[model samples]
Structures are given as structure tokens and as C-alpha cells.
Target: MRRKSIQNWRRSNSPVLKRFCASIGKSLGLPNQVADYWDTMLGGKSSSTDYFENYLLSEIDSPIVIGLDHVEVIFQYPEIASNFFCLLRTWNEKAKYGNSLSQVWEKLRLVVVYLTEVYMPLMIHHSSFNVGLSIGLPEFSRNQVQDLVQRYGFNWDSDQIKQLMSLVGGHPYLLQTALYHIWQQDFLLEELLAKYTINVRIYSEYLSEQLSNLRQYPELYAAFTQVTNSPTPVELEWEQALQLQTMGLVHVRGDRVLPSCNLYRQYFNVSASHLQEFHPKSGRAEG
Candidate 1:
């Protein structure tokens, strides 16, 4: 597709996207034709985030609640998550008031649509799900996922909790994304996190990208080192957080990951070559 795949799409916020999507959609009263053409180009979302959005975008919007379990689903397809993260940024920048991304999430239809279409199919077949699943989080036994969520203090009624735990585990990435999804989907935020788990391989590519960034932008690395080496606090940037989360470099901890993990801790953590092998998309690593 000329419209680059998920990865390229998330790489940056083209200043023109808002204007582009809006101009096309508004000019035609609804870019039905463009959207239809997109359907053909992208294969019409047979089973993915776009599928969910197809239905969700037309529904309610506001005061939605999300649990960590929900975030796991969104993470399953990180490419699509750019929209959610971007929407969050947009809301943060202009909310018609002073609310933050969290407040806007519950009312966000675009993200909800994304979760319903792309991730649910994966969830339906998995035994256990977590953040690592996108990293891909292996589906676990039913009992395991339930237990993971319970541990996080989110009370998913045993009845539909499975829906929540479908994508990932207790891993911070999955945990945070799950939470974000639930809010976007209009559910109650019973628990902040419903599960946890670990999948290191997916993170390796993530590490590579980080190192790539460091190498590409030495100044950025220098900025990071100042924060890493100093006791003084560092200001957080939503733009960077959006990039890292999209690249799978860190988990979502209340909107920011702040670099915490074994991968993050060791030798300044530049071993993407080692980690890439285990990734679902990337082949196995060498000995």
C-alpha cells in the first residue's frame, strides 16, 4: 500500500494529517469513497484494529472507563495505537478545557474502534493475554490471565473479565495499553491493571530502535544521559513518550514509562541485536 504500513505511520506526526483527514472527510460530507478505497487498499480489515473502528467510530462518546486488561488488546497491534496516542496528545494540547489524555480517553471513539476491530480476534483464540503478546504476549491458560488481573487490583467480574485479559499479561506495556483501551471503549475502570507478564524478545527490536535514535541523534542521547546520570528531575515530553510507546521501548505507567526494566537497566541496554530474534516478526537471534 502506498500508505505505508503500521510502523511508518507511527514514526511521526505529519503536521498535515489532521488537515488531510479532515479536509477529505469534510469536503465529501464523509470520505465514504476514500474510506472505501482505503478498505480495498488495506484489505478491508478482515480481522484487526480497523475492523473494530469500523463499528466503534459510529457509537457513543464520553465518560468511558478502561481497565488494564483493555490496554493489552490495544497493544496487540501497536501500529494502530498511534492514533490513540496521537488523539491523546491532541486532547492534551486542546481539550476545550484543562483535562488531560485520561479524561479524553473515555470519550474517544477512534481508539475504541481500533481495539474492537484488530485485537479482539486475537483475544478470542488466546488462552492468556498480556502486554508481551504485542511484544506478542503469549496467550496463557485462562486461570493465569485472571490471576494476573486480580493481582493488579482490578476487579473484573469472572463473567466477562476474559474479554479484558485477551491481549497481554501483567507486563507494564500491556498493562497500561489495556487500561487505555478500556477507557476508550466506554467500560468502567474497575482496576487500573488487570494482568502482567514478560516477553523479552519483542523488546529487543525496541532496544535497537532506541539505540538507533541515540546514534542518529546524539543530542537526544546527551539529553537522556543528563536525566539518567543526574539526580535532578527531568521534564517529560509527550512527544517522546508517544514515540517510545509506539516503538515498544517502554510500558505505559500513568501515561509515561520512564525507562524501567531489566533491559533498560543493563549496560545502558543496547542489545537489540540479541532481542530481535524472539520477536514474532523478527527471526531468531544468533548464539
Candidate 2:
């Protein structure tokens, strides 16, 4: 996970500030004054709420939309993440509840994108984050996949498309990668499927890292191995199952866990006998 500090967001916004300052300087003929005070006015430590109101909203003539992606990075640092979220909640509340700062705070619209749900770690009340629009991205439907393939100029029959889906289970990333290779390298669907059954170079690093992470927690690794080797779905601890699901390597069906796709099954289906050999030395040391 990227351990970016909160200052990173402020740093990114610096360029926007500079541009705005330049325009203000040109209009008012005070470039020297603006340059001298810009650092003092914007750089000092303050509540995120104050920063949003005084700087972001005050400078812009129209509504300001702020988007933060991969917020999951903060999950590793729970206290910071919780405090940051609370600060956002405070900003949102000030807008909705009509505080003295609400006039400016209302101009700020925050769009946060994270891999997992924030409630899993957020310290504030659930209503804080729930008040805003929440959109859940769903996997692509069969028609969507077919349309994507057609756009790539692959005139595959239904059976071929089904074969590809069976291997990738309609996963957007895997399907896109497969289609990219087919379109760019002229690889046949059969050739791609065969490579996937053995070892897919495109997914090698990701697969390795996932496996390495699994080794860090023996229970998760054991659950993964059990599910991969089982012909039928197997039950795992709810948290373990969730961890696997979060990794996009397993799917939870009612009370059982199953490999997310045939590709995962083929690649991660390590038998108990192979566990010792496959375990990472770093994981062993930590253990």
C-alpha cells in the first residue's frame, strides 16, 4: 500500500493554487505580494475543514470537486485514516447543518474512491459517509463482455466467448488483458487459454505477491489451499473468506468459498505436500 501522508494531497493542489495566483496577479498587478503570502496562507498546518473552506472553496468561483482515489492506502494507518475521515464528516456536516462555515464548505464536494468499504475502519458514525451518494461498481455482464470483444474486432462465436468467460469468470481486468494480447499479438483464444492453464506471464507478478501475502498469515494460506484443492466449495472463517474475496482470488457463495475463476484454481491449487516448498522464507521468519 502507498503510505502517502495527508500533505501529498496539499502538494498536488499547489500547482492549481499557483495558476490561480498567477491569474490574480495579472488582474490586480500584485504578483510580488501574492507570491510572498501564498506559502504562509496555504502551507501552515490547519484542520482539513478549514483548508477546504478558506483555500479551496474561497479561491474558486464555482463549486470545487475533490476526488481522492485508492484511499485504501490509509487503511494501514487506522488512526490517521479515522481522523481524516472525521474531518471530512465535519466538513460535510457543516454544509448540511448550516454552520457559519457552511457557506464556504457547501461549495466543496468530496468524491472518495476506495477499494473496500470505509465502514470497516471508519471511527465516525456510519451516517457520516452514508449521507452522500454511494455507487457500487458491478462486474460486467455477458452482453458487455461481448460488446467489448466485438469492439476489439474479434469475431468469436458464442462458444468461444463462453470458453473465455469460463476461464476468467467475466473479470474485467483479466478479460481486458486477454483481449489486448489477442488483438495485439494475434494470439488465438485457444493459445491464450492454454497459457493461462500453465502460467500466465501477465499475471505472474500479481499472483506471486498475493501468494507471498497469503504466506504471512498461515490461516489464510491454509484456507486458500483447502478451497483450491477441493472439488466442491469449502467453508473458511468469515474474515479469511473476506480477505480472499478482497484479493479477487476467491468468491463466497452462501457459506462456502470457491476460487474466483479457473485461472486462479489452476495457478493457486497447491496441495498440502507442496506447502513447505512454496512458503516464502520471509513469511517463515515472521512466523
Candidate 3:
């Protein structure tokens, strides 16, 4: 499902688990009376684990795929997150048991998408993330970017593409945004790159969102600061490096880390003073 649809629930005053169940019930096409009945009956005494297993088995008769995007927001609620994820593992395992109920569970497929690793601890046996066919999308290569440029009907030469890649690396979203704006004649390629770091017109919202996330975790903010400020790759704590790499903010080479792209380095560097406010003491403080 779209992240925006559920993101507001995360910030709501009501209990997250209730909102979560309500959303699921709605997706299952249960009427409000039935859903509310279940909520009133089970909300106080049981967890989502019980609700999903019992309800999904009886409710669904066809193959159902639930795609959850931006699942990282749930990490902030560890108890609910852990319980829900473990429930997913249980559902998957139940489908493999070769019992009558297996047929029901086998019809249920899950697609959980998140930007970063689960920093929080989860029992391996109970973790659904470990069992899935994980797919990690790598950044586009230079050739891929060039292909995209041509696909966008741009007749730019190799050097022009190179200059654009140098600024945004091969980030798909950034490349698309730049290409779209230039294609619309909003700015020339040279003008776009020249004013990229200074102007907030292109990547202001994206950069601001990343900055806000980093501010939430001071150690991550500090670790990213070091990576951006350095001329060469810098060493970071294993967890810190992993988290930053997963967040698409930095690239890890061996034991060293560097900014993922010139865009990140330039944008974050300009905001370095603001970042320093998050961790005034050390740039390498552990999160």
C-alpha cells in the first residue's frame, strides 16, 4: 500500500495497533460492523498476531498480496513492530506445514518494504525479513543513466550525462527529477548543476526530509557528517555504516564510507552547521 495512506496513523493520538487492525480489516473488505466488533472484542485482550491469524484464515478465499511500503515508520513502535513482524513469520511458517489451514495461509502473500535495516533486535526465528527472497536495488550505472536520458528524449552528449551523474550519482529519483525539469525547459543542464547545491528549488523537500530523519538519531547525524565532510572515505562503526548505506546516504567500501553522491555531500555540507546542533560534542558519538 502507499506509505502516505498509513503514515498519518503513525502520528495519530489513537493507539497504533488499533489503527493498524482497522486498516487491515478494511483491506480485507470486512464491513465496519464486523471490524468494529472484532476491534471491541479483541483490541483490549489480544495482540494483532491473534487478530490476523484468526481473521485471515476465515476471511480470505483467494490469493491476496499485501504490499507494505515505508515500513520503517513502524520501527518507532518496537513492541507492535516486533509482534507484527513475528506474526508474519508465523503466517509464512503456517503455510508450509502441509495441513488443512496451510491452504488458507498459502493464499496470503506479503511484501514488506522499508528503506533501512531493522536496527532493533528481533529473534531470528521470528523475523520475517530473514526468510524472504530479499531484493536490494542498486543505484543505476552510468550507462543506465545515459539510457534513461535518451529514453527521456534528450539528445545530450556523454559529457553532459557525466556531469549530471557526477552531481546526483545514479539515484533514480534525482535523475528523473532533473531530467523532467530540464526537459520542461525549467533550467538548462549547466544551470541545474551550477545552482543545485545553493538553490532549494530542485531537491529542497527531499533533502529537508532526510535532514529531519537524521536529526532524530544524533549518532547517525554525526556519522553522516563525518562521511560528507571527508575528502576520502571514512571509517564508521559497523552499524552506523550499515544504516547510512541502507538509507542511501552513503556508500560503504570495505571498512570505509563515503557520501553516496555529490548531491548529498554538497547539500549536507551546506547544512553542516545545522547538523552540528544535533550533536554538539563529538562527530563520532555512538547512537
Candidate 4:
């Protein structure tokens, strides 16, 4: 049960995830086809909210999960809000009977799921970027994460955690983004002392690398200068931002685009200005 709690919503082994497979199957109306359908879903590797809505939430003649209706509540349709709450109320009741599919279907399972989605992100919010980075690198282990946090003091809040989890779901890129900021801030040096700091050295080394990558990827770097030098800064397309984002040099925040982290921001601006000052003679892009 303890192991189950930590491993919630995480079922890699076929035999191990049998129960979760069974539960999801029950929710979908085909208790026996749980494993079969699950295998197919994973094999296809499709990521569509519509697929989840159809596979996990469509009206079915089977036991419902605890929070299905809450998804509906947040579903963003005014007409569906009342209907979703009513569906949720029924699911809550159906879960209460002596034969309550949910009550004994797995308490540990419920807790595991709660930890997997809700609690994990909440805990991650206040933690160090290295901690979040470690979480992403090591697949998904709740206790390992717990130990990581306890070993190195970190913090989290309810909302930021959830927002990040949903955005990246602990994927390496997104997790790294959040952590990059956190860790970068701590190691960063002010402009005066930064020249002597090892972090600056490392970042300067990294900036050099970015400079090298730009030689082969002019399309990506084109937008960086294009924005600052433009009479009216042009809107960058997603494809144009790939190189910048992948190298951790910049990020897109809504309509506004900026550097990936403060450290990068400082380094990028300083180096760019420096390049303008010295590039042989002409400080103009080659026509």
C-alpha cells in the first residue's frame, strides 16, 4: 500500500498496473477490455484531450472515477457547469454503496493518483530547480522526490505547482525551464562581481556554444536581432523559436518573448552589446 501510494497513476509494468487498468476500464464500460484497449492506446501514442474526453469521460454504463465531473466543471462551457456538478454528485453517491465500486476499488489507488497529479506538482512548486530537474531525469518516483526535498530544503504552493504540472507534466523541457530559473537565480552574480563568478564563466561558455549553434541555425537567431533592431518588432513564429528555446537561451511568454532565465538574459544582452562594439569594423548584419 505504501509503495502503491507513491507510485500512483504510474503503472509501467503490465501485471503491476493491472488494477489501475481494471479501474480505468470499469470507468470506460469495458472491464475486461481494459488491458487490451490500454495497450492499443499506448501503442498509438496520440495526445489529444478529445481522446481523453471520449475514452475517459464519455457517457458510459460503468462505474465512474471520483473526479470526472470536476473535469467537467472546469470544462469551460457555461451550460455544462450545472450538468457536470450533477454528474459529479451522482458519481459521489454511486461510490458510497456497500458495493461502491470506488470505495474499495482501491483506497491506495486513489491516494496514489492524488499524489501523482495533485500533490506532486504542489510539492514541486517550492523546490529547487535541481530538484525538479532530478525528478524529470529519473522518470517518476514520489518518495525519491520526497527525500530530495527533505534533504535539500525547497518549497511549493498549490496553484503554481498545478499550473506547471499541467503545462509540462514533469516533462524534461518544461521541468528544466522552471528549474533553470530557480537555480540560475541562486547562482547568479550581480553585474559588478559577476565577471569573477564561476556561474558567469559557465554561462559565458554556454553563450559561446549558443553562438556556435547560431552559425548553423541563422533562421532561429534571425528573430533575436530582428526584434531589437526592427522599426516595429516582428512577431516570431514557433519554428523560429525552436533553437532559442532548445538551447535554453529564450522563452515565449504569450505575445512577448524574452530570455530563458535572468542569467541568460544578462549574459545574452551583455554579449550582444559587446559584439556590437567590436565585430572587426562594421556593426551591421551582412547583406
lDDT of every predicted structure (CA atoms) = 0.39, 0.65, 0.73, 0.39
Question: Compared with the true structure, what per-residue lDDT tens digits does model 3 show for residues 50-87?
Answer: 56556744686778877888776666666656766776
How do the residues 23-136 of candidate 4 rate in per-residue lDDT, one tens digit apiece? 655655653544334454543222222233334544354434343212311222333233323432333333343232343322211111111111111112222111111221
- Candidate 1, 55-152: lDDT as tens digits: 32333353332222344344435355444444434432332333333333334322221222122323222322221214343335567656766665
Off by over 4 Å in 3: 1-23, 31-55, 96-100, 117-128, 197-199, 274-287
Tally clashes: model 3: 0
Model 4, runs deviating above 4 Å:
1-198, 225-234, 280-287
Candidate 1 weakest ten by summed lDDT: 110-119
Query: Candidates' TM-scores?
Result: 0.27, 0.70, 0.79, 0.31
Runs in model 1 with CA error above 4 Å?
1-109, 112-202, 229-259, 267-287
How would the candidate models be sorted by TM-score, starting from the highest? 3, 2, 4, 1
Q: In terms of lDDT, which candidate is strongest?
A: 3
Model 2, span 1-287: residue lDDT tens: 13344345345655433433344345433332334444554442233334445554566666666677776666555545565666666666666676776777777677877764221333333634576777867667789999999999989889988888888877787788889888887577888777653345776766676676666567777788889889999999887787777667788999999988887787776434455465655233233
Error (Å) of candidate 3 at residue 32 is: 6.8
Clashing pairs in 2: none
Top TM-score hit:
3
